[model samples]
Target: MLRFLFDTIFMVKVAYNDAPQPWQLGFQDGGSPSFEGIVELHDQIMFYLVIILLGVGWMLGSTIRKFSVHHNQIVHKYHNHGTLIELIWTITPALVLIAIAFPSFKLLYLLDEVIDPVITVKAIGNQWFWTYEYSDYVNDTGETIEFDSYMIPETELEPGQLRLLEVDNRIILPVDTHIRFIVTARDVIHSFAVPSLGLKLDALPGRLNQTSVIINREGVFYGMCSELCGILHGFMPIVIESVSLESYLLWLSSQNSPPYSPLQKPHQFPKLGNPWGGIGTPSRGKRFYSTSSSSIDFATSSNEEPLPPLHPWFVTGLSDGESSFIISINQRGNGWTVRCSYELWLHTSDLSLLHRLQSFFQVGSVNLRKSRPMASFTVAAIDDLFSVIVPHFTNYPLQTQKRSDFLLWAKVVELVHSGSHRTESGLLEIVSLASAINRGVSDKLQTAFPNFTPYKRSLIEPCLSGLSPNWICGFTDGEGCFDIKITARGSGSYHQVECRFRLTQHIRDKVLLELFISFFGCGKVYIRSNNKAGDYTINNIPDATNILVPFFDKNPLHSSKLLDYLDFKQVVELVKSKQHLNPEGLSLIRTLKASMNNGRRAKD
Candidate 1:
């Protein structure tokens, strides 16, 4: 029976080898251990346990010997326990336990201590996959590439691969590098754990948890989902690959390519021919068409509004033919006078047409009790007296001014109109048609025009000035429209000339504008219409010319009439010669000139 029991025990130990293995018994060079210190304490405890066991065996043998020597006596009795002996036994065990507890406490504290890590990686947990982002080590351009790692099915695993241990792309690391991982989830809770590293962290939704790991080995390691998530939870696996820094970088670059996959059987769905069919061809078609038709109807109804001829002008184009402007008026406090103004700029050079158009509004006075106009103008343009009639203007001031001031003040009118015309105490309401027009025109001009002559002229002047010879360098690549202003100083009365150049093509317009601006050495040239009809100014006038205009005597091909038409260029040269052009003006010139030559080639 003893022999049989011994054999059975040996086989049991061999069959169930679940206890600590040889490699796990002590810390290896590359493996992390549960404890690092108190080696001597553990050794002393083991020695004492052995000695005590031997002493107990010897005492029991002596007792047996004594019984044999006596040859009789079935029982043996001992006197009451002595206090000294009892005290010695109890104190010795207490000392042993105290020795064990000291190191154990220290180890616990050490485990809780989180050292500063060299790198931080944010891991976002998804349904059945993990996304990893390196918060540090961004590229020179400040772009970071994040990627997802998903499990590789069993059938796709290689020969020696462990089941449920493979991932499509393994998390990579540099060996012996300390990395801090911050884990969080977007939906359900998940856990990030790697057994070999002895690290585990819970990823709670909407919460962040951090843990650190220092990889010691340069090989592939595997882990699985520790939490029981939904149905496909068991399928999620994590694989980590540690390599040298060079190898890791190489692997990272190679990962830019798409991943490879193996062929699989076609997915099967419920048969539509059956009575209990899930979805049929007709049903799917109807669902798709219904969704599309509903979307169209919703869009149409949402945008339903009356279309107007010139809808609210948006920056880029006209607002979708609908009344894009909105007006709101409210009184704040007690009785207060209100002044409203509106302003708009007409691109066309037709003042009479504008005057005729102004006939739409009439001036009038209003009584406190009346809701309608008391007095108003039937015609806005009545000879030299241009007037505006308001149906109800009793409490309001009868504000009138010249056409120029009117244009400028019209912006304020628009603001007042937008404010609903009612002004309360301490509040001034203004409606600016000019603001809207500027925004709308800017957007449309950028798209329809694409290239601006003024902007281009601003680009090229510096390079031309840097060239040899003080000769005036300017060119009109093609017919282009520009706003120019000429001002004479030192008692010289300069002729205020207004000329409109028609650039043959938009490309030529851009080129000529750039060349002109660049030669003048102006950085940013503003095209300002100074509240006057037909007269616009190029804010940065060149200082090089003797007269405030370009000289035709310098160039044989230069036409005096053309020079007069292009007086803006002469002014720029005059300013340049006098060194009156500021840095901004110079920059504008450089930009304009460069743009002309740098733009796309003209379409032949």
Candidate 2:
């Protein structure tokens, strides 16, 4: 009998240690120090339960036998209740409860208390997936590492991997480090829980809840969204790969190299070091390639691996904001050369973006000008000028003052295209065309060709009567902006960042922009200055997130507008996550803001 009992106990112990087993009676063995404490607390509670059950069961059974009719049971003790018996009954139960409460309180305190965390991870729970942001770490090039971890389908699983639990991107962490997880939701509520690690916290929308854990062992731990978020909630499993510190650092270092596209972090990231050389570190031989699979746009890429293409419409929209076209008159030997140059400039921080843009248009050599904070891609070569630059603008036409310049510049290119620039007549025509270009003839052009009648062309009015999704998108591409305004509340960490989705148009088009207000089902059209172009905007968080976000998502804006929208969306999510309430969250919010529209720092 003793041997049998010992064997049963041994089986139970084995079942608990080997997790997720069928018919397991005990909890999975803990992998962290906190989890260890939790397991110990569970054991202690079970022991008390067992003791109480046995004592009560024995007493009842003995009383039944002694007082039964077969044993000549008698009625006794009619009038008086013993004070000692009452005291014993009340005190004894109270003592047991107190005993249980002490250990329980200790466990609760430990679970709630977050210790000094070396690293912070923001886990954003979406409808069917998890987006994890490593707020504390950046690659050698100062690129933030953030990624979305979608569960790998069964068909993609490799040998020895669990189905539905494995993910395309695993949360990698260094073992034996206290890591704080700031969990929140984007669209729905989710619960971030790992049984082995004894961690479970609700990922609430518009509410940031944080918990800390120090993984004491290295292994692949599987968990899932415990909350019933949506249809694919069960499919949204979490796979965390805990590794040695050195291995984790190696992975962190590799995240910045190749194939991954890095969004420029201009104002927020420290610009203390050289761009290629890295921020205060030696030049990492491998180049930085930011990927969404990371994170914050940086990831390691193999040389053979191809980079993703920029969407044509997106390129068009971005150009509408950041690009320029001009026909300049340059003083050269013997005669002034009429140079029709198309230049697109971006910040030095967005080096990858510039390269991507250059790759897309397949024209204009990307040049770095250290004197300016911006980098320029100029198409001075006449062949590239007509073939690439001119054709592109014609196909996807510009819609601003830039478009007016592009038209005059196109005329010059046409002359050059016709080889008419070789003659004196064509050269004089080109000079007149340059005078009519942007800002209406430079001071030098006026000085050179004194009393020269500037070539004049009527400004073409954009067709603004239409209200279809594409038309609205095109108009917004030129005239709209997604602005994230930050308001400081001294030292407090709440309500710091505010967002407004605005479209500006002349007051004459107040009725036209009002069409947008009607179409969006939110926001209002308000006249500013009673005459100048007014703002049709939605500034409230709920309307912006629920209404404006969905609209743009359906009729996606192209170009740099798309990048700005992405950053704007991230800020909306950060605010929703209640991240503004803490220092870490605030730091990350500021980092994201650095890459936002103009990185404007407006203090109120």
Best by lDDT: 2
Relative to the true structure, candidate 2 reaches a TM of 0.43
Against the hidden reference, what TM-scores do the models get?
0.33, 0.43
| Tens-digit lDDT track of model 2 for 1-604 | 6756987878643223423656867777677877888888888888989998998899899878887788955666584688998898799889989998998898889888776566688899987889988766543223357778888889888997777788889999877666789999998899998888888999999999999887867787778999999899999988778887556655664452222232322222222232112123221212222332222111122233546766555555556556777766666424666656777776554445566667787755554443455555556667777888788778777544456678888989989878887777787778787777766767776786675667776565544332456646655665678877777776643547787888886564556567676778789888886578778998888887898788888977643466678778877877888776777877777787776677532210
Off by over 4 Å in 1: 1-89, 124-129, 137-145, 184-191, 202-207, 227-235, 251-604
Backbone clashes under 3 angstroms, per model: 88, 16
Model 2 lDDT-worst window of ten: 293-302
Q: Each model's C-alpha lDDT?
A: 0.40, 0.69
Q: Kindly report the root-mean-square deviation of model 1 from the true structure over all alpha carbons.
A: 27.9
